[model samples]
Target: MNVILPTVITAGLFDSLNPCAISVALLFIALLFTLKKDRPFILKIGFFYIISVYLIYYLIGLGLLKAFSLFGATHFITKIAAIVTIIFGLLNIKEYYFPHAPIKLRMTHDARFKISEWAYKASIPATVVMGILVGIFEFPCSGSVYFAIVSLLASKVTYLTGALYLLLYNIMFVLPLVLIFVFATNRVVTEKMINWQERQGRKMHLILAGLMISLGTIMLLLYF
Candidate 1:
């Protein structure tokens, strides 16, 4: 139990640092800014959005854990998961060289458009919906860490414990969004934040790739 909590927290921290997630939050903040520059409106919408993302991601984790649990803690499943993680890791690494590659995990144009459309509604409920959609769209980019942690939970932890860990993980995952909203409201998040992210994008990819590869390799080594 102790081990599982720490592992899940670590994975959550890495997943939270994911550039893909950060980019989406930045876009949402930009959208909110366009709609209303006031701190209250932005804070309200952003808070709801983060809540929606957190709740949906937690449910998804539960679902994945339940599904993976059905596989009966098989070594084969771990091996397969490890292999998939490595493939994703390698693909992320490749993004460093071919940054424009269409293969890098990202939201489809359609998905982004839909989220934007939701924002246009200018309602609290709409923001929640947009958050749900964003979470779905971000699955590809964030799935590796989620899957690895859930797989481990399925094999080694109880459902309740897994759920608790998931709660912690998701809270960590959305911390950046909260911070972005707070900073943006305070006039701290400027063009510089965006520019910095752009400049560091490649490096973030490399870090994610290394983390994923290391995770995969660790999973693989379990069999040895």
Candidate 2:
């Protein structure tokens, strides 16, 4: 079977742009600076957080793919997923226009509060726990894209291939965080990074919407 690396890469890129994760990471970076100018501590906190998020996503993807493949191929369900994806895309696009729209892809207030509390502690274990919790919190917002990717994987490849794709997807998902942390700690474009996010946050939503719409349309066409 042909490996759908492109799909995995694109999905990972889109999923990684989720505001919840990025916002929290940015806050953590800021907290790190406020707490101390300890570069090593910053690196350790960021590393653990990123790795924990990747591991949680990998486990979820692996288990879900295995469970999904057990049912064998389900073209009908895939078609439904495509439709749902398109709806999610539209909702995302709507959010660009109505930023306060009832439909938003974001973490719950409780989750946000918990993360903030954990981030302030600036401990490796706490950061790791925060990462795991954040991953779970953000899943509802970003899971559709991952689900779509996994559905495609289950339909087109074997379980092992699906697992490999999940691994690749998660690595790419955390790449931006890794880069952002490195830059912030090095004092390279730290302020610029935050500013850019402020300016491009809405635009990111549009881009994700377009990506989902395109991917869903193609899936619909392919499956039908």
Instruction: Specify the highest-lDDT model's number.
Output: 2
Relative to the true structure, how large is the alpha-carbon lDDT of every model? 0.80, 0.83
Best-performing candidate as measured by TM-score: 2
Badly placed stretches (over 4 Å) of model 1 are none
- In order of listing, the candidates' clash counts read 0, 0
Let me know the TM-score candidate 2 reaches against the reference structure.
Answer: 0.94
- In model 2, which runs have C-alpha deviations exceeding 4 angstroms? 1-3, 186-188
**Candidate 2 local lDDT, residue 142:** 63
lDDT of 2 by residue, 30-73 (tens): 77888875888888888999999999989889887887788765
How close is every model to the real structure, measured as TM-score? 0.93, 0.94
